[model samples]
Target chain A: EDKVVQSPLSLVVHEGDTVTLNCSYEVTNFRSLLWYKQEKKAPTFLFMLTSSGIEKKSGRLSSILDKKELFSILNITATQTGDSAVYLCAVEGTIGNQFYFGTGTSLTVIP
Target chain B: EAGVAQSPRYKIIEKRQSVAFWCNPISGHATLYWYQQILGQGPKLLIQFQNNGVVDDSQLPKDRFSAERLKGVDSTLKIQPAKLEDSAVYLCASSLVGEGITFGQGTRLTVV
Candidate 1:
C-alpha cells in the first residue's frame, strides 16, 4: 500500500513567525508530490514537485522535494492569521493513477 | 475558468439512511475524483473517473458506496444504509492529465 506521513500533526505560531511542515512517502512508481492548503472547506493547490532539489515558491509559501530521501517540506515565511490552515501532502503513483495522502499538519497563526 | 461544483453544502442523517452528493467538474477537465475527509485527517480518494470511465475505486466501500459519471462530465456518489463512521466531508475534484487538481467546497455529511 502507498503511504504518506506528515510530521508535527499540529502547531501554533504568532503572526510573522515562520513554519516548516514535513512529509514523507513510500510508494512504487512515484510520479509526483503535491502540497495543498485547506481551510474550512476544500483544499487548494500549493505546489507540485516532480523533480528533486528545485524549489517551487509563491508569495510567502515555498516547497522542495528530496526524491533521494522520499520526503518533502513546505515552508511558510512571515505567516499571518490568514495562513492558518491544514497543510496536506499527497503523492501520485504511476501505477493506476492513484493518489495517497498524509494525515496533514494543522497550523494556527494567532495575531 | 470556473472551479469544480458540488451540491448540498451540508446534510445530516441517521444510520441506515441514504444520501447522495453531486459534483460538476470544470469544463475541459478529463479526470474527476471523489474524496472522503474525516475530521482531523487529510482527504482520501474514494474513486476516480476518467471521462465517465472508472479509472480507480480501490478505496471506496463497494458494499454500500457507489458513484457514477454517466455523461463524463457531472458525477454523483451515493451511500446506502449509512453508518456513523461514514460521517465526513465528501469533496469532489477535477484535473487535466498531469495537472494540479481543483477541489469543490465539499458536502459535509453528518450521520447520527
Candidate 2:
C-alpha cells in the first residue's frame, strides 16, 4: 500500500522559535515530494523537492527530500504567529502519477 | 494570471440531499483535480481529468458522486444523497503535467 505519514500531529511553539516537521512515505516509483501551507481557507504551495540532498527554500521555510530514506523534512525558522497553519507533505509516484498526501502537521505559533 | 476558481464557497445541506460544486481551472492548464478533505486530514484526490477526459476516478464514489469537465476548461462535481461522512472541503486544483498544482479557495460542505 502506498502511504504518507507525518510526525508530531500537532505542535505548539512560541514566536521566534524554530521547528521541523517530518514526513515519511512508502510508495512505488517516487517522483517528487511537495509541501503545502494550509491556513483556514486554501492550502498554498510551499515547495517541491524532486532530488535528494537538494534543498528548496523560500524566506523562512525550507525542505529537503531523501529518496533513499523515503522521507523528507520541512524546517521553519524564526516562526511567527502568522506561521500557525497546517503543513502538509505529499508524494507523487510515477505509477499513474498519483499523489498521496500525509495527514498534515498542525503547528501553532503563540505570541 | 487568475488562479483556479470555485463556486458556492460555502454550502449547508441536509443528509440525503443533492448538491453540486463547480470549478474553473487556470487558463491553459491541461490537468484538473478534485479532492475531498475532512477536518484534520490532507486532501484526498477524488478524480482527475485531462482535457475533458477522465484520467482517474478510482477514489470517487460513483454510487452517489459524479463529475465532469466540459469543453476541457470547466468542471463540476455532484453528490447525490450525500451522507454525513461527506461533510468536507471540496478543493479544486489544476496544473500543467508534472508541475506543482494550483488550488482554489475550496468549497466547505456541511451535511447535517
The CAPRI-style docking tier of model 1 reads: medium
DockQ for every prediction shown: 0.74, 0.71
Name model 2 segments beyond 4 Å from true. none
The Cα error of candidate 1 at residue A44, in Å, is 0.5
What TM-score would every model get versus the actual structure?
Answer: 0.95, 0.96
| Tens-place lDDT digits, model 2, residues B1-107 | 99999998999999999999999999999889999999998899999998899989999999999999989999999999899999999999988756778889999
Query: Candidate 1 lDDT, tens digit per residue, B1-112?
Result: 8999999999999999999999999999988999999999989899999898999898899999999999999999999989999999999998875676789999999999
The single-chain TM-score for chain B of candidate 1 is 0.98
TM-score of chain B of each: 0.98, 0.98
> Model 1, residue B102: displacement in angstroms?
1.6
* C-alpha lDDT of all candidate models, in order: 0.93, 0.93
